[model samples]
Target: MAWNEPGGNNNDPWKNRGGRDQGPPDLDEVFKNILNKFGKFGGGKGGSSDGKGFGLGISLVVGLLVIVWFISGFYTIREAERGVVLRFGEFSHFVEPGLRWKPTFIDSVLPVDVQTVRSLPSSGSMLTEDENVVRVEMEVQYRILEPYKYSFSVTSPETSLSQAFDSAIRYVVGHSKMDDVLTSGREVARQNVREELQAILEPYDMGISIVDMNFKDARPPEEVKAAFDDAIAAQEDEQRFINEAEAYSREIEPRARGQVNRMAEEAQAYKEQSILKAQGEIARFEELLPQYQAAPKVTRSRIYLETLESVYANTSKILVDTKGSGNMLYLPLDKILERQNTSNAPSTNRRTLEGLRNQDPAAENGPQDTGIRSDRLRSGRN
Candidate 1:
């Protein structure tokens, strides 16, 4: 029954509807009053209901914010990179290549590319050992080997790396000769730079590994380039001249030595021939002297006859004894002598006069005649 029914007493019959001993209001009424209080649109009471509604709405917004906060803590890492987690600005752990999450607002993550090669160029002017200034250009290739160290050990790794490169270049170049730096020193310079840079980075814990370094160009300053080129050309010309002189020496020295050796050999042969001929002539004279002592007269006659025959073989004149024949035989002795002195002397001197007999021979051959015979024998020997 409703409380505002017309049949109801002015005292409120509904008050007694359940019973005077009822402990509290009806359950349905209690629920109805609670719904009404919540459903109010305006006023302090309505505002209180609105405050409850606003509290509920605030709770729902707070729940969504919490969900988003949880999601924001999660992160992802790619295959080529490594993640370093820092808890309160200090390194905590490392994560690799996948989805990962860290405590929100309490931890931070830094991703470093460990596999990718990074390049930095270094260039500057430096003094060499020869006290020459030159410009050098080079590139360094590096990669991160320790991600945690790269992220946390140094505040600025790239800056430190640049400084290391500068120091290495200066140190290497300062000690090198200008010519070497411009030419064959490129390889040496790269090696030195790599070593020095590695040392510097290791001490600072930069976590960088140098893969390779390359020298791009090294040259003298623009003001001195022409002079350097001229010097190089001069060096080349000097080497060429030296090579040509050496070649000429090689070609001529052997020929000159051979000619000298040939002359020496010819002189030696002539001396040996002269000595052998003198020895042979001496031996023949020794043998003939013994034979002549055994038969003096016979040997003398034979030698005289042989000498006369050899002397007159080519002569047309007849030598007749003037004492035996009063008529003198006119002989061309001058013509025979002239012919004997010419080109046919050797062959003409070989004939002998065997059958000529002297009608009026001179008494014994005297010392003058013997001297004449000796002269003829000596001439034939010669």
Candidate 2:
């Protein structure tokens, strides 16, 4: 019967002897007997309990090994790590950063760095769609997003990513023009390559997310590098010239517009002034119209004299065709006026006043006689 079965081995070996009840072996006696057996086995081949002592030593050794195995199972994961656990060489679960324990010799943990960014470089001279070759260098930054996939999904995630990088870049370069690969279209090419790379990598799902992709440098091949450099320099110069021209336009356009506005204002002011002057002249003529109607001959003579006076004031010479003269007379009126002006000098005027007071009244018409003589001489010249 089993030991715990009722009415069976109570049969308890400690209490039963030869099917009769004997008090349990005394504790003191049992211990003493074990010690004596140990002492005899250690001293010499003098006891029959040697095999039992050997068995006890084996049990103690097995227990110590078991305790060591349990203790070694305890492990600590660093803050920047993720633990990928595998049970019996197959994926099980992931563990976070902290102290953790697992069944000894039954599971394994692979720590992967998830927080750090990794860089991969790609560079080569590749052909473009326009049958041109360009040397390109690029850098790709990535981080692990799924540790399980990083460790178990692929044999080599980095290598796969590198291949994908090459494929994406070559595809983009092959479809783009050489100018795009090497010059102003660089940013556009970079964006296209990144998008293509992401598309290519999507199916693989290697548990890596691209942090950034930089187009480090792009240049022409060695055989034509100098020529390409010249072309690039020319393009830069063209852009610079265009920018300077635009700046000049921006600066000059406002001044031109302002000049137009100023000219327009001046013309408007001139128009208003001319209009007002014409209106004033018309009003003055209207006031004279009734007088001319009442006395045509006197009004006509007065108007002619006033017109002559206005014309003479602005002129230095006059022309006169005498009533029956066959030729024109040119009068040097400016010279006569100059002589008359000199006669008003301080000393000359004072002398003339004294002379006039002592002289006869017949000489009072001296200036008039001289003016008439001047007129006669002007007519004789004609």
Q: For each candidate, what TM-score against the reference? A: 0.50, 0.56
Clashes within 3 Å, all models in order: 0, 0
Q: Worst ten-residue run, lDDT, model 2?
A: 360-369
Instruction: Give the per-residue lDDT digits (tens) of candidate 2, residues 15-61.
Output: 56777778666899887577556656545255544556656655766
lDDT (10s digit) by residue, model 1, range 250-308:
99999999999999999999999999999998997898799899988767766776666
lDDT of each: 0.76, 0.79
Q: What TM-score number comes out for model 2? A: 0.56
Full-model lDDT, candidate 1: 0.76
Q: What is the lDDT of residue 242 in candidate 1?
A: 95
| Residue 16's lDDT in candidate 1 | 57
Best by lDDT: 2
What is the lDDT, from 0 to 100, of the residue 137 in candidate 2? 94
